[model samples]
Target: MRSDYFKNTAYVRKTAVSSSIQKLDKKDDELAFAKFFIERLNQFRKLNYRVVSSDEESSGADIYATAENLETLNLQLKTGEPGLERFWGRRRKLGSGMGIIDVNIEDLLAQIIRDSEKHYANKENLTLLITERYQPVFDKNYALRISTMFGNSSFKGIYIVKLPSFRASFPYEGQIVAIKDIFGNHGEVF
Candidate 1:
């Protein structure tokens, strides 16, 4: 009985350690993605955006950016597999492949809606940007979906930026797409 108890305890301990490691890996990936996004955004000569802070624990936003116009772009960076569960407190594994990722529109919208309200309250001309790693595949109906979810809010816009793999690349090109009605106009591509 003593040996069995010890074996079970050992197993539980190992499992807990493994889970903790996985969470740390996810957080590390998120931070890496945030850094990559900031680097790419900075490449645009037209925009002078600065990274205010990159603290992982900051609940407000992963990274905060400000352009020359003094327009604050509160950015939340997420990198993971595609699923609605992602918006509801779940993290998916990021594949190494480089290509367009078909992200869940509803999930992304849900996150934007939740974060914009929670983070960007009272700030005018505030842009609550939710940037996802890799390309997010969305359809024409995405505009309507966003409009329905937005309701009444002070958030000026929600921008989704996708990009190539965060590797030393030969060529790079990316854009930030705004959900049309959610912002009332098209956002600039960086």
Candidate 2:
């Protein structure tokens, strides 16, 4: 089942890339990512949650999730790049001696905040799901920083899902860090 999940994720990612190159809409990608995110959430929290795509235009939520509690959570999904394109060009370079790659977490947070404000109209009961496309180094401190940064935001919860490298055999072997949640908790979900 786990292997099948990874294979499905890989296929969704490939489709997302192809759609991107074709300048087509990424509705399928958004739904697939939402489902994947919910699956991980369910596994980590031991909660049976199901996700469905929302009419973003009317609901201001990319996806909606519901659990046994009958409580619905609106999620605003955002995918971000590692901001390493400038160094490696369009195609990412894989090899040794790549040197240190600096990732500005503050800038990324700022962008997320901006995107949330610009794209979402209703923020009540809304959770932010940011899926980092490439592998970016994030420690507990960074997670704390993220929590602190979005603490006062309109979102009820905020989470970051960092994906593994493209070459990784276990694509789902990544971290899901919660920046903020209903219980006022923060840290790695795993």
lDDT of 2 by residue, 38-60 (tens): 88888977888899777755787
Task: State every prediction's TM-score relative to the real structure.
Answer: 0.51, 0.70
Which candidate ranks first by lDDT, i.e. highest? 2
Pairs of residues clashing in candidate 1: none
Residue 1 lDDT in model 2?
A: 100
Q: After best superposition, candidate 1 residue 168: deviation in angstroms?
A: 15
Error of 1 at 21 (Å): 2.4
Model 2 scores a C-alpha lDDT of 0.70
Q: What lDDT does candidate 1 reach at residue 118? A: 70
